[model samples]
Target: MSEQITKVNSWVLGLTGGIGCGKTAVSNMFEELGITIVDADIIAREVVLPNSKGLKAITAHFGEDILLPDGALNRAELRAKIFTNNNDKEWLNALLHPLIRIKILNDLNNATSPYVVLVAPLLFENNLDKYCDHTLLIDVPTSVQIARTVKRDNTSSEQVKSIIASQMSRADKQQKADDILNNDRSLNLVHIELVDLHKKYLQYALHNKTNSH
Candidate 1:
């Protein structure tokens, strides 16, 4: 199903990267330049908030064991279940992806900035990049990804590696991306590249707006 059914006035620039590839940092740079960021991760959490339809459906399927005593999702418990069971993982994705996509599209449509950055780690994996006018991949080596994720999340290198394995390969992501920002270097250097990208996106947004009219 197309995530964007209605006309989208704003230019949507999809930003994606592997875990610990500094997607947040890159999105923040765009925000600093007065761009709006529509984050799928944040929307995913919002969809399953206590008493929401998403959570209720999940509870019906997985039972109350999927929720914490405080009524929030027991993410750890759910994660474990999905990890061991491929069917359970597919079930959960089928439930949450549409909800998340709707919210993301709403935010993208409501954005008043020159362009909207739709930041999703699973952009290519879920085909969300198809809706974007352009796709930017934040590139980094697998070793760097594992090291950064391990340090940032206080998780084991093995766990990080497993997560990376689940994602699309770095080479595939690079091949799919319209633009790539190699983030293996210092933030100063990355920022310089981003500044130029920001200008390009602005021009693209303007061009889109003109064409829409």
Candidate 2:
């Protein structure tokens, strides 16, 4: 979402995947490598906190129906509404994308790790890849995506399908990524690949640091 970092001293890898594609697990593996991770999902929640301006704007546009009894955003209801209506989805994105971008850039600029991982499900959709030195996709087949998502979210098959349909397709994402990691196998195997990528990223970070002088 952000095209230029106000201050970014470290290389950033934008990691993304479709829903139910094991993004969290992959992000955790990157974290275990001691790479700092700036998570879009966590920041998305933060921007919409009870009294935040982001929540205020959302309520103004979508109305109080989008809020729960405790004044928090009714994520489920909002998700349903947006997915069903293109106009609602566009409006919500217009409101939140800028807020999310600012927060993400701030986090990136402040990162102390050799390289930072910007983990976002909508990395490509939101054009967040523009901020990163490289885009890494966690790849999986659509069938696997549906199976894992339905199991993890306990949502209906049709709903999972709808969410999957809403996102950028696997093929398009793979084509756009600078690199990709197949995630359909066991966690141990995934970790082996991640460790290898960790080494590669460290080398990239070091090379960039040397060139910046």
Candidate 3:
């Protein structure tokens, strides 16, 4: 595939974490500091909205059963089907990943913040890390992940474990990260770390902007 990122206008920060690792909270902190966040999960859904080309093509390939009565993609059904079948999952990724990447790039470019965060759960999985100037990983333990996810999603511990097992492992993500935010502590501590990172990112963006002139 071609580069998902085009000409850079500002620094791009890739923020990611394994399931139930408080990624949303981390991103929210960045947002509070006036950093724009282009969320992959949001764009992934937007690209396949009712009557969208993505949705149309998906319906043609997966049939109407993959859509809800209101013409929305049946996300739960699609997820279940794809999870059980590797071919189906690959087919789905082939269809959606490129589209999602394009939207992410566009959104990143359009961001007005000093620096922007490309927030994605699968940032590493989809190789979106390439688009980033730096990667930030939110870290937590597997046991904490299971507990938090079950509490948040009301899902079974087994199901949460399965979800965690599917993503890029914590150790690998930690090694790949340019920065790390340990989310195992209180929210106040997380906020302090975010403030520090926000300052660092601003400086990075300013440095880039100055060099570009």
Whole-model lDDT, model 2: 0.91
RMSD of 3: 1.6
Candidate of highest lDDT: 1
lDDT tens string, model 2, 8-108?
66799999999988989999998888889999999999999999999998899889999999999999999999979999899888888888888899999
Candidate 1 runs further than 4 Å off? 1-7
Q: List the residue pairs that clash in candidate 3.
A: none
TM-score of each: 0.94, 0.90, 0.94
Q: For model 2, where is the 10-residue window of minimal lDDT?
A: 1-10
lDDT of each: 0.93, 0.91, 0.90
| Per-model C-alpha RMSD | 1.7, 2.3, 1.6
Q: Write the per-residue lDDT of candidate 1 for residues 120-182, one digit (tens) a residue.
A: 999999988877999999999999999999999999999999999999999999999999999
Query: Clash totals for all models, in order?
Result: 0, 1, 0
Candidate 1: which pairs clash? Answer: none
